[model samples]
Target: MKGILSGFLVVVHLMVISQTSPTDFLFPAPPNQKELTSQKLWSTQYYIHQFQSGGKIPIVYADGKPSGLFADTCDFCMASLEGTAFVKDSSGNSTIINFAKSGDSSFVNCRACKRFAASKLNVESWGRTLWSKSQGFGDGVKNYRLVPFRTIAVDKEVIPYGTVLYIPAARGKKILLPDGEEAVHDGYFFAGDTGGAIKKNHIDIFTGIYEGNPFPEVIKSNENKTVDAFIITDQTIVDALAGLHLKKAF
Candidate 1:
């Protein structure tokens, strides 16, 4: 009886341990938890663009008329930070001075969400190639479609554009400055509004219901969705045209 009772107790202990242990598949342990923090020197938001459909050619505007050619979306729509004022009272009380001046620090317009010509044509060509090799070009190429997309703004300095970044939660400790000495944030950038709950080094991404168009819909649905992103930046590369403009425009 004693031996049997002891075996039963061991089995119960094992069961409890198994239940309490963290599952490897569901919640994998992070590589370095101590290296992550939220302190940041400069925090700002930028836009994000996501592609959905393929095949429809984007219309271009020339003199307020349709130019019948494709135009890169980001070429026209620009994103920038907004200026704000902070006020304090004589009694050591502080408050936001103005609300009207608070504007959307990060945003993208309709023109900035259009499809690229290269991507559209490349997809079409690939479909034709695949069809010709397998079944027949006529049947396969008929369904070819141009890809469409939507974009939002995130932080620019923290997550460099054109690099894939993953946000673990809607909020988490971002790994900024690997050494963890100075104030900085490293992780995915998220879009935030002027009046929203924004921390010094945190971001707030937007998501909402919209038209059935897959392009824009995907971007909207991505709110709270953990994803690895490849961000791009316009300031990283050196361009002769930009240098000339800088000298001439000023």
Candidate 2:
């Protein structure tokens, strides 16, 4: 019985790792894929209160189009979908990928393809979100929020990049700020990208905003230091993110 239990544990572990690991889902039909909505997908899996700084959580695109983050098969290089092939992921040049209605999928390469983590990502930031150019990742090409949630730099030691965090808002719970303001606790985020400033117990969240683009002054400012977030480690939750990663429609 002990041996059987051990084997079962190993199997479970393997399954979890496999799900958390990166698996490519084909998104050939950009239009249909854009039609997919997180509302239906997250109806059951996500529900945790996000105790962050001022301003409501970044709103998910209502049109059902994702922030357009394709995996940088080659680190943070310039990558984009062209027809059915992933190209120019290592240069600053820009290109376009057209997904037709036939629905053919191609795999994008990743410089750092890893699995989910079980620890709090050690990153050092006041918890703000920024986009490609602002983050110094060059957004001239195909700028995308690849991981679905607001991106964040994580400590590889704590939480491995690509881990999905389901930060739920209380079932209508709002938080009062120290400066006589109200902030709602809500958002679902993921750990897709990373950064050097990310250290122990600190996470640098990517706002997906470029410097020139108009953005809230609060995000760039260090006003909100530590935001409380709930990390989801359930296998089912990981599976859900994987299913949604890189693909368009639900």
Candidate 3:
């Protein structure tokens, strides 16, 4: 009868409603949508006890580079600027010019794409990044892997050398690239290196330098940002960073 038909339709409607995904309440994506990979989480309130700091890749200028960059002293100038490059002429070849903090006054905030750098360019991939001196550590090693992220310099008094740490991603506005690419921090770093600037609760993160292409993105992202760090007591993880014969200074 008519009553039975109405009840059946109501049941069908309820079934469809139940099948609806709950994600719709959170992220309502359009036709084509994209997301990022999953990283661990960090709580700044719990892990942080002191003021955070930043490290940098000195902007090397042509044939006239920074001074005393050898032997014992450092005189490298460093900075963090998100550059926006534009293709000025589209003729036989594209002439692209990037405008950043140190660049010209004209093409300042112009961009080719919004959120441009957050794509698969992979921000976190800048892990093994740094800008060491000519005679810095590992300059003579055949295969030295103790310079970048693997060898984060820490205060020996606070977190001793050879101690492993698991830093989860901190909740904050996504660190955006020059072109709008976004990323958070989440990974394992070892306490292996040291420096005069690195003291007390201060931890130095080394994202090895890339001669012609220093890792500006990683340098900018981790600069002075405080996030939760978990002391990794797991022997397996610690051994991987400390090698076979090495021991944790803890």
73-169 per-residue lDDT for model 3 (tens digits): 1111111111111111113121111111232222111122243333443222122122232212121112223332345656678777777665543
lDDT of 1: 0.23
- TM-score for all models, in order of appearance: 0.20, 0.31, 0.34
Runs in model 3 deviating more than 4 A are 1-145, 170-186, 210-225, 244-250
Would you list the C-alpha lDDT of every candidate in the order shown? 0.23, 0.30, 0.31
TM-score of 1: 0.20
Backbone clashes, each candidate = 24, 21, 13
Best-fitting candidate, measured by lDDT?
3
The alpha-carbon lDDT assigned to residue 234 of candidate 1 equals 23
- Model 2: per-residue lDDT, tens digit, 1-250? 1233333333323322222211222111222223333221111111001111112222112233433433322221121111111112223222222222221222322222242122123211111222222112211112222321234445667666666544333212333321223434234455654444445545544322111211121123232343334555555545554444433311
* Candidate 1 lDDT, 1-250, residue by residue in tens: 1233333333323322111111111222234434534232222222211121122332222123332222223322211111111112233222211112212222223223444333322222111110011110001011211000111223444532222222333122322211112221223332223222233333333211111222221233333432333322223221311221121222
lDDT of 1 at 49: 19
Select the stronger candidate by TM-score from 2 and 3.
Answer: 3
Candidate 3 TM-score to native:
0.34
Instruction: lDDT winner between 2 and 3, please give it.
Output: 3
For candidate 3, the lDDT comes to: 0.31
